[model samples]
Target: MNDSFKKIAKTIKKSNSIALFTHISPDMDALGSSMSLYYAIKSLGKKVSIFVKDNITETQATLVDTNVFEKDCNQSEYDLFISTDTPSQKRLGDYAKIFIAGQRKIVLDHHLNDDLKGDLNFVDTSYSSCSEISYQVIKELKVKITPQIASYVFMGLSSDTNAFTNSNTNASSFKTAYELTLADADITNINELLYKTHTTKEIDLKKFLYNNYHLENGICFCLVTCNDLKKLNATKADCDFFSSELINMQGANFAFSIIESTPSFYEISLRSKHGYNVRDVAEKFGGGGHICAAGAKLKYESIEKLKDTLVDTIKYSGE
Candidate 1:
């Protein structure tokens, strides 16, 4: 094992109680790595808890035990704190203070951002997902890949890679998937739940997105207002993956979806095709993610003003 991996493994082994965390708006990759490591450490007889500030969407919760996540962390201290799929402590939301309070902290991530807040950082941008990195860490810990752990890891890998269609996918990712399948992970079931299954409300929102999206200067953008969501009876979960879908539009180098989750509060999801880097766009708004896919949350006075600002930002950035 490499020095970084070895250091992380040694730290985990020495710790008696471990706390795990991810970013604010936790995605499948974040949840997958955190929960998979939770099982691994628990199997080793270590006390473990996952602190998640955000409520997991119903679709993502199906991949693993939702009970594993706690809204609040009660412990005054932990032996070790590990963050997965989170670039910085700021993204940890309310749990940032908890992570800082730990005796030792480690960050396992795949983002290109180097502003790591962990005492021990194991970050590899080449890795397809944080789940893949966690797989390596668990292997070094000598933890057996149980079916349950394998399933969670597989869920993370599939979702973050967009079913292995994103640019980040590589031979290593497929090899890891193969091993997880050998461990009896239910790949078929994961695929159906993540990709195939969607509620009626989700389908209608997608239709609305396609019909109403604005296209200009190689950018395709759409907005889902709070009123629109209320009329369709859709939650934020129904809007997931909409930005990724927009990136598939013909001749569009960049695509974005702005969701008004609450009044004047917007969640922006950005995607890029043809080697464009959406992470730069997101970073400009104080968000950071992968090169092709990134996001940010903002609050504006009005949706019209938000759209105008976003269009100008995207146009100028793309040029």
Candidate 2:
């Protein structure tokens, strides 16, 4: 349970400079909630900075400002570091070193099996998205949610819940959305860019996944290697919805998508529902998330080897 709000608030109140961070290859929930907290904290007259090693993917550019994150962080300038939506230091990617170097750290996450033992922590898996937890943090800080801040929280909530259609969605998700709307959240931008719109490249990737998905033993899975992406002129970001789409298969109990981020490095996203547990599979690969959704990134020597390892691991895990 998240039982340390007073301690977290006290830490923030004492710190003069702050640095904000999130997981590598941040999804909407990761960036949105972190940046919202950045703005809220800055409003309190504290110097705040955001440090991220990766660029915002093309699909994410629709909702996030690319300029909002910096490639480098000077650790000496910040008195405290805050991480959002990230479950572990390994998930921090290149930023893990800087995060480890921080004298004081705070983690606010909703993912299960967390390993980031911050000086201050607030982790609650009961929430559908980290944004909901962030909303509570803002409230505890007594900061009013402005339109911009509400937009971030709302985007994080909507994206993480897949427009409130995922199994994780609960009454609190809608209630938070309602309150954000009253705060003038930019629903139009979120609805249009995140849900309504798609690029030609994304559509092409969708067609590719549709044609290539494998169904065996109630599991439907698909993957795109560097060669596949090169042939399609698509990037990994365009494959964001592949797992979500595969989960729609009528007979499948589990769906997964593996996208090669670079060379032999792969990024995998898993989805499931109706009592199935994909998080268990992800943890086997040193990653974790909600019961119905999870992810992992790994590097392999070859596509064939990667496929073999994944198949064997999933089989061993009884996935």
Candidate 3:
């Protein structure tokens, strides 16, 4: 409906080949939105490729036809490079070069990060999910969104909003929800795959992570070492559902999950209620996201040191 949306539609219309991508360890929203856009682009009889850091999980493998690449293909052979749901170009993982080195790039995202580098960027943190933005793009393009496309968009929105439970859910989100319903997107099917489909390893890892959570000063924290991941045979995607749940604790104003991806380093995921400023907390540690949810990485002598620093950083007035 706006000038930028119309420009994006025209860009997509003219491009013959487009490659869609997301950050590493693609979450449901990232994967869902990327695949949804892939389908919409491919429907126009253009060549489209969907790239991620790794192969799709059994849960999401069925959501799209990902045969464009065999194994993390790095060749940049597309006319248009489109990235979705990612904050930084570096977050593009193996395909970061394709985004940075490519001539034409379009970034559609919802995360609150200032590192957006692209020829045409549609970055809005106000939207609940990148999928919500994707829906608007397709609508502006007047593209025929198939049932499967709508379903993937629904999954992306539902996952990022925590089933519409997060604070970002707004009137636009609900209006998109209504449009998806009109498009005959199976809400039941989407919910079943999202909520009901979980591996035993993921479930066990979540339980272990929750049990290990340490609550102090209105901040809920947990540390999952690499060994913990090996024990659960879980990948980063497996542990994603842990951070938001910790914030669900009735009394806790904030929650943090520090995952030890390697020795002497940890990836910290932060979440908080409406009043707490999580972006400020994440920025202190050189990470960023939304006010309610954000993340940072810390290199420490030990995990204990990381915990101590984070605990001190979170202990502020009006918390």
Which candidate leads the pack in lDDT?
1
Name the better of 1 and 2 by TM-score: 1
> Candidate 2: global Cα-lDDT?
0.84
lDDT of 2 by residue, 197-259 (tens): 877877888788888989887788898888898999876766767888998898888888888
- Can you give the lDDT of residue 196 in candidate 2? 83
**Model 1 Cα lDDT, one tens digit per residue, 155-227:** 9999989999988899999999999999998899999998899867667877888888888888888888999
Model 3 lDDT tens row, 42-125:
788888877765645666665655565434544556788888888986577667875777778888998875675778878888
Better of 1 and 2 by lDDT: 1
lDDT of 1: 0.85
- Which residue pairs clash in candidate 1? none
Q: Where is the poorest 10-residue window by lDDT in model 1? A: 1-10
Q: Which stretches of candidate 3 lie over 4 Å from their true place?
A: 1-3, 55-58, 62-76, 317-319
Q: In candidate 2, which residue pairs get closer than 3 Å at backbone N, Cα or C atoms, i.e. clash? A: none
TM-score of 1: 0.95
lDDT of each: 0.85, 0.84, 0.79
What global local distance difference test value does model 3 have?
0.79
